[model samples]
Target: MILQVDELGKMHSGKQEQVLFAHVSATIEEPTRICMIGASGQGKSTLLRIIGFMDREDQGQVLLQGKDRSKWVPREWRKQASYVAQQPVMLAGTIEDNLRVVSTLHQSVFDEKLAKRLMERAGLTEMAWSKPASDLSGGEKQRLALVRSMLLRPAILLLDEVTSSLDMHSKQLIEMMLMDWHEEEETTLIWVTHDMDQARQCSSRLWFLAEGTILEDVSTVDFFEEPRTQPGRKFLGIQSVRERKWSGEGINYV
Candidate 1:
């Protein structure tokens, strides 16, 4: 296994203590695409944060490549399992500066040629690369952030709705870029997306999370065709209704 979570537990302690999740366990084998879907506040992002080592778990262990994540330095852990948030922050600089800064990290070297090619694939014009990154559009920033993550050459990529606010063109381009990046046999993807169609498009496995636990983990085909659990069925049913309504086939409520 590439990564393993052993009874991971996280809780909030404040004026309002909240138990985000308890006794949650999952395994991520190498070189596979897994999509995590759940309603908002169901701990999808929380789980990703824990996995990325951005947040601490109240309890449980995170193992990477058969060793505890604690055994690896934070920088080394991040270099192997990188994360890109929904709202990516762009530093005060040109696109070139932003791309070049990744070289200072412990991961992959800065490849100007590869960076330019990635920009081209992401539908960014040469002029845009010279413009200040802070002035770029939301979609453009997302594309650049994706490129930055890719430059790290992480073994596992953790994305949390990275393209949610993007236009269709930008969304499709990002999806394509991610797919191309995962063409290698050593890279794994753990994507957290609310878009079911996009989830199906990019992931081979679907992990259904509800009430702070993974209710089911199955192949994407099985998830849609034959959901095993009631929660999974209900989730699929709701999405099906939404899709139908979107197609202008509203239910005839007599």
Candidate 2:
């Protein structure tokens, strides 16, 4: 398996303990594209954080490439498996300067040609590269963060609503770029998205999370056509309602 979460659990110690997830076990093997869908305040981001080593689980083990996560140095492990947060922060410099930071951190030669190609693919103009990163819009920052994360060519990428801020055109561009990259590499993708259409397009499997646990894990085909759990079915039903509303089909039922 590329990555494995074995009975992993996380909890917060507030006035009343909040268990984010408990006994959550999942395996990501090969270059499978897995889309995680859940309501807000669910543990989708929390689970991604644990897998990326950004947060520690209360119990259970995380294994990467058949070895315990503890065996690998934190930095090296993170380089191989990276996480892109929902709200990304940019450095206080030009776009090119921000992209160049990857080379400095990785001790690898910067690939300017590849950077230029990626920028074009991401719909970033040359002029945008010279502008101060702080001046960019939310969508621009989101794309810049994606570019930075992908530059490392991580083996496993954990994306938490990475395209949430972009317009439809930019969103499509980034999705195309990412799908092309996935097709050309042996990287595994675990994307958390509320956009069901995007999930259907990019993922081969769907994982439904609710109430501090994974309610469903199935192939994308089965997820939409044959959801076994009530939560999975309900989520799909909601998506259907939204689609209908968007298509001007009046909804008579709540």
Candidate 3:
């Protein structure tokens, strides 16, 4: 398995600890695309954070390449399973500085060519690399953050609504760019998104979170066709056959 999430659990710590979720398990046999879908407060982003090593789980473990997360250094694990937050916290300094920060910290040569290519793809070709990253708008910052993460070329890319801030055109560009990147690099993409079109565009498998656990883990076609649980069916409102057909393959990211 490339990555394994074995019976993971977390709690909201306070006067009374509340169980967020438990016995959550899944395994990635290879580099492929999977989308996690659910309503808000399902611990979707929390799970991604755990997998990326940004947060520790209260119970169970996350494994990458047969090694448990506890056995690996945090920095190294992050390099392999990079997380891109919905609201990105930009690095201090120029746009170029943000792009090259990962390589600098990792003591690896920065891929300037790839950075430039990604910036262009993100519709940031006109943006000055010398400009302060903090000066960028929210949408621009979101795209910049994504470009920075792509520079790491991690095996598993953890994305939490990375395109939520972008305009429709920019969103489409990113979707296309990421699909191309996934194809070229064979990277495993685990994205948490409410945009069903976005989820459908980039995934083969869909994991539905409900009732404090994974209610369904199945192929996109199967889940959309007939969700096993009532919550799953409720999550997906009534869509016609033609609309559901797009969920299968008709809607291309490109």
lDDT of 1 by residue, 115-140 (tens): 88788887785646678898888877
By descending lDDT, how would the candidates be arranged?
A: 3, 2, 1
Q: Write the per-residue lDDT of candidate 3 for residues 138-216, one digit (tens) a residue.
A: 9999999989998999999999999999899999998988899999999899999999988877898999998888879
Candidate 1 has a TM-score of 0.89
Ranking by TM-score: 3, 2, 1
Candidate 2 lDDT, 115-208, residue by residue in tens: 8888889888654678899988888888888888888888988999999999999899988988888898767889999998999999999888
lDDT of each: 0.83, 0.85, 0.90
Q: What is the TM-score of each predicted model, taking all chains together?
A: 0.89, 0.90, 0.92
The global Cα lDDT (0 to 1) of model 2 is 0.85
Better of 1 and 2 by lDDT: 2
Q: Candidate 2: which stretches are off by over 4 Å?
A: 13-15, 238-254
Candidate 3, superposed: residue stretches over 4 Å from native: 239-254
Lowest lDDT 10-mer window, candidate 1? 238-247
What pairs collide in candidate 2? Answer: none
